[model samples]
Target chain A: MIQIEQISKSYNAHAALKQASFKVDRGELFGLIGPDGAGKTTLIRILMTLLLPDSGKAHIGQWDVVKDYRKIRQHVGYMPGNFSLYRDLTVEENLRFFASVFGTNIKTHYHLIKPIYEQIEPFKNRRAEKLSGGMKQKLALSCSLIHRPELLLLDEPTTGVDAVSRQEFWQMLGTMKEHGITVLVSTPYMEEADLCDRVALIQNGEILEVASPKNIVDHFSSHLYRIKGKERLGLINALRSLSLFTKVYPFGEYIHCTSDEAVEPVVISQQLGQLGMDEIVIEAALPGIEDRFIELMA
Target chain B: MDSIIIDQLTKKFGSFTAVDKVSLRIQKGEIFGLLGANGAGKTTLIKILTGLSGASSGKATVAGFDIHRHVEKVKMNIGYMSQKFSLYEDLTVRENIQLFGGIYGVSSDYIKTKTTLVLDQLGLQDSAKKLVKSLPLGWRQKLAFSVAIFHEPKIVFLDEPTSGVDPITRRQFWEMIYAAASQGITVLVTTHYMDEASYCDRIAIMNAGKMEALGSPGELKAAYQVDHIEDVFIHIVR
Candidate 1:
């Protein structure tokens, strides 16, 4: 439903997007995965026609982003990275206002936002500014869906939200996908990439890789290892000091270590033991999207 | 030594309790992690501890000063950095360091030395004169953290400091945290990232205004019979 071709945008000497190109298939849940200032927002804004790109072309369905900006606005719902709803307006009022802005009524599209809106419906009379962070996010999502656009563009919708809320937000998006609404969402969290049918990894305004999550992980050529023990920092430093491992970094309860050649867990255990680092747990591990992203970035 | 001590701390808004008699002690030079969902009262608790807001009941001490009886002393002894609250976007990096140093009452000479050290550590020597708004999010976060602890406060508070930052930068930020703790500065942090729980010396999980779990990551895992901290959190907060 969306096609972007060599789109680039720059401000002064810094390039926000350097010849970026990607596509979102019809009814596909595509993710733009990157950290802050990776041009995810710039790409989304260009597609929304809120900001004009310096070069290249983009289209939503049959209309060009520049030539038919008005037509595109009617078909895509955008929730910006920052909350953009009327702060003083009541939750219900915000939804109603957005519905009218698109020449539609809430009743006509109530089903589109019902799953998410109902979670905050009890506070429909509350002002947008008074709601908590999660509630405000749900309200903004409700407003965006109240218009029932064919496509949804979410910019870091789960960036600062907690895990539970982030999970629920993805579930809401899943429902949207089931209804044949195409989604193009951006997020800094690498774990969220698993939820998308396909994702484009971006960094410093450049696309690093594009593939399904499984495909991305499958391409991780090295055998990974999970190491955990006391003196977490010491363990990381010790592993880094060794020339045997290609990557050694802290990951949750354990350290994710990788090497260019196959290495046994017993070898790592013995090496650390000889260094006076005892009680270490070493095991073979599978690579996740985060591991793959870090490798690609490196 | 205990850097922070709390006894039956409680905060209320009208009839709703935002913090319910939460009590915990943190040792000096320790990385303590606070984990919670939204509306779980993590912010409320942090506010009470940071002296930005008061508790309706209970008692607490931060940085060896009573939070209620010595608000100014408490504020002076503690540092705070969050994704949304730190730094002046329009100001240049050097200007921000100077401004914060002045606010913290650090000696100008110390500020000068530390500023150079910080810029060197983050590889921002060339961009020190550039506006903070122009820096990438990772650099901004690193700079903000340095400014927070520049005064060498007894304790530092980081609220989701790595949120929205790249994975590599996030790990780099933790290295700084480890360095600070090694210097005998206590660190209290709140985050939504579950993996970060393992980085802490100890972690407390808050749910609905109450601390549902508190222990080291290994202990929590053993207690909950789970392999990952995220599983332990989900089990407690579900």
Candidate 2:
């Protein structure tokens, strides 16, 4: 249960957030998806009361962000994008310190973060700085949840961690949600846009679109075809020159081309063959979240 | 030509070996990506090549200069943007450029032209006088990148330059990298994002202080028979 209304923030001339508004339902794994400088962090800061907004208001349940910062801080687990843990402190020490700050002991909420803590428990004596990026992430998440807050706010928590660790971190977040803790995570990866229950695509501090990942891609009004040929560069050049294609993005070994009008696979293969292409495979395909984001951005 | 060459490179910090026998080659005019989870020795390897840290027992040459010797020449020939936005937060955008330029012994006249060029490229011409703390994260990241390579070093080392920027900004940042490569500037970048590794000309994946795989993204993906770099990485590291 979070509500943000018309939040605006700016740093000198660069506008970070321009009256952005959104809401997160209780127990929802909500995602604030955007590129950098999209005001996702600013919103998180405003909600956490770490930074005050120039205008607008935000609330966590009944308390306001600006007026009840202390109360909100106690109730919201926050993992900042930056490495905020004391570099010199050991993993266990940092967890204990954060737990004490929230007037709770690590053991009191140890089970809440056991899945993550177990990964770093062996290195409990290791300093925060000495741990790997993935270890630091787990330690940070563990500390943040030591108080068993009602909400969790993670700002690109997996940005610099490995893919497997990123997956593990999301799994931990899901466990938190099982306990009825509302989780709000922000990420820059377009493919990660679907991990949450719902995502709000943001850009330049404005909400572009908010919908389920599948819904977003399904709503795309263009027909897409996955095509590939022996002459990669030549095929790419020829396909771009064709006016029928709306978008031609190279996806691994194949080219995902979106067309203004639905065309037969034979037509695509014939055109590529005419471009002196051989072994060309053309088939109708589904668009991904990143594809949908590109289309939205376009 | 290979802009960088590493032969059985290894770096140890006391009892812990940070980069263990890592060897790789990066070609000129190519955008080479380094992939690793955190603490996988990506940054340590970069530091060793940059001469920021001495390799424990390895031979490496960057831009044709040996890492063990010619440290100053290595620093002069390479422009580095660290993972953190290491710009002076208290200084104005232009002042940061001026300070860095002065440290590098750039002429006042060249600094003036370069500052304007970089600011305009980052769409921050109007905010040149604004303090670094007053800039948005995305703008600041672009500016940091511009500042790192302002002197036009032969090869640029970017350590997770797009950690937090949104997808659109990341795309735009890649365009800038392409532009740099077009000018024959070799790029050595480290990132955790697998998708980003796909966009690179060649990518080397590392795990547990050793290189897991290295090749053009296409080749690696094809060899692993995967649709994305993420799956390829999973196949190798697992």
Considering the two chains of model 1, state its CAPRI-style docking category. medium
* Candidate 2 off by > 4 Å: A9-15, A49-57, A62-74, A83-109, A125-130, A223-259, A263-285, B68-76, B83-153, B234-238
- Give the C-alpha lDDT of model 1: 0.90
DockQ of candidates 1 onward, in order?
0.62, 0.34
Instruction: Please report the candidate that would top DockQ against the real structure.
Output: 1
Cα misplacement distance, residue A196 of candidate 2 (Å):
0.8
Please, what are the lDDT tens digits per residue for candidate 1 over residues B46-116? Answer: 99999989999999989999999999999999999998989999999999999999999989999999999
State which candidate has the highest TM-score: 1
lDDT by residue for model 2 over B209-228, one digit each (tens)?
A: 99989898878978999878
Query: What's model 1's lDDT at B67?
Result: 94
Give candidate 2's TM-score. Answer: 0.81
Task: Give the per-residue lDDT digits (tens) of candidate 2, residues A223-257.
Answer: 99888665544666688877768877665446678
